[model samples]
Target: MDADLPPLTEALVQDVIYAWCSSAKHEITVPNCGAVWGPEADVVSVTRARLGHEFEIKVSRSDWLSELRQIRGDRRCAKWYRAHTLTNAKEEAKKTAGLAAKGSNCCGLVPPSYFWLVTAPGIVRDDELPAYAGLMEVVPYRHGIHQAHGYRVTETRPAPRLHRVKLLDNQLMAMARGVTLRYWQQRRKAA
Candidate 1:
C-alpha cells in the first residue's frame, strides 16, 4: 500500500468490488453516479450492457454523512457540476430517469437498479441504507499480493467458487490490443 493511500481496509474493499465486477464480465467505470448526487455528480459509474442501467459505486468507512459533507466541499462538489450541468433539479431528475431507463432496458433489469455504497466491514450499519433499494454490502477478502520495493505482485491462490479477477496496470495495454484487433476484424468482414 502506498503511504499516501487511504486505509488498507478501504482499498481492499474497493479491490474486492473491482474483482467481482471483473469476474462477472461487467464493464466497470470509475467515478460513477448513484441515487445521491454529489456536488459534482456521481463517481465510479459502472455500465455493462449497451444502454444498460448504470451503477454508481461509493466507498465509505465510517461517518458517511461526514464523508458526504466533504464531498460537498469546493473541490469535490465541483465534480458534480462539472459532470452534470442541467441548470435545475428537474432537469437532473429527468436525466437520471433517462439513464436508469436506458440501463434497465440494456440489462433487462428494472429502473433504479443502483448498486450503491459498497464499503468496508462495519462502515455502514444496516439502518443506514434504504430497505427497499439496491444498496449492497461488499465484504473484503484476502488476495495474495506481496508488496516489494513500492510495487505489488499477485501470487497464485486456491481456486475458490468466486475467483478474484486481478487487473494490473498492463491490462489497459491489452485492452488497446483487443480494440485494434476488433477494428481490423470488423473492417475485414466489411471488405
Candidate 2:
C-alpha cells in the first residue's frame, strides 16, 4: 500500500462502487442489504431494465480468499458451478457440505444476475477471479503534482450475465423497502 494512500475500507469501496454503478446508468444502489440480498453483499444495485447486480468488497487478500471458501454450489458462483458440475455429484456434495458449513454468509443464497468483486489495487489479480464474477479496483486518479485528487472504481474485467431473468417485482420492492428502512433508521439515529 502507498504510504500516502487513504486506508482501504468498505466505506471507500462502496462509495467508489456507487459512482461506478451510477455512471453505468444503474437506477438504484444500496449498501448493507442483508434483508434484501445476502449478508455477503457489500453493495446491491438494480438497473432500469430490472437486472440486479451484487458487489462484494474485499479489502484484504485473506478476506477475499475466505469469501471464495464460503459461498458454495452452482447457484452462487460460476467457478464453483463449473467445478462441481464436472465432478462426481455424490462426492462433490459431501465436500461441499464441509466447506460451505464453515460460513453462513452465502449459504442457500440465490445470486443476482451479475456479481462483482471490488478491491483496492493489487489485493487480487485478474486470473484469481471466478468466471462468474467481475473485478474492479479502487485506484487513485486525477493526479496532481503532490497526489491524486481522489479514488475511482475501474473495472478490470466485466462480469458476465449469470442469468437472463430480471429481478421479480417483489424482489425489487424488497430492495426499495430495504433502502427506505435504512434511511429512516439512520435518521432515527441522528435524532
> Using Cα atoms with residue i matched to residue i, what is each candidate's TM-score against the true structure?
0.37, 0.73
Output the TM-score of candidate 1: 0.37
lDDT for model 1: 0.37
Q: CA shift at 90, candidate 1, in angstroms?
A: 11
Candidate models: Cα lDDT each: 0.37, 0.69
Query: Among all windows of ten consecutive residues in candidate 1, which has the lowest summed lDDT?
Result: 155-164
Clashing pairs in 2: none
Candidate 2 overall lDDT versus native: 0.69
Best prediction by lDDT: 2
Q: Distance from true position, residue 190, model 2, in Å? A: 2.3
Model 2 regions lying over 4 Å from their true place: 71-110, 143-149
Q: Tens digits of per-residue lDDT for model 1 on 1-191?
A: 33554454444544544554455465743332232222322323334432222223355554565654444456645533422231232343454455555654322112222324444345555664433223444432234322212222121121111111222223223344445665798899999
**Residue-by-residue lDDT tens digits, candidate 2, 104-172:** 443333347677888877877766777767888878866522122267777788877766555645556
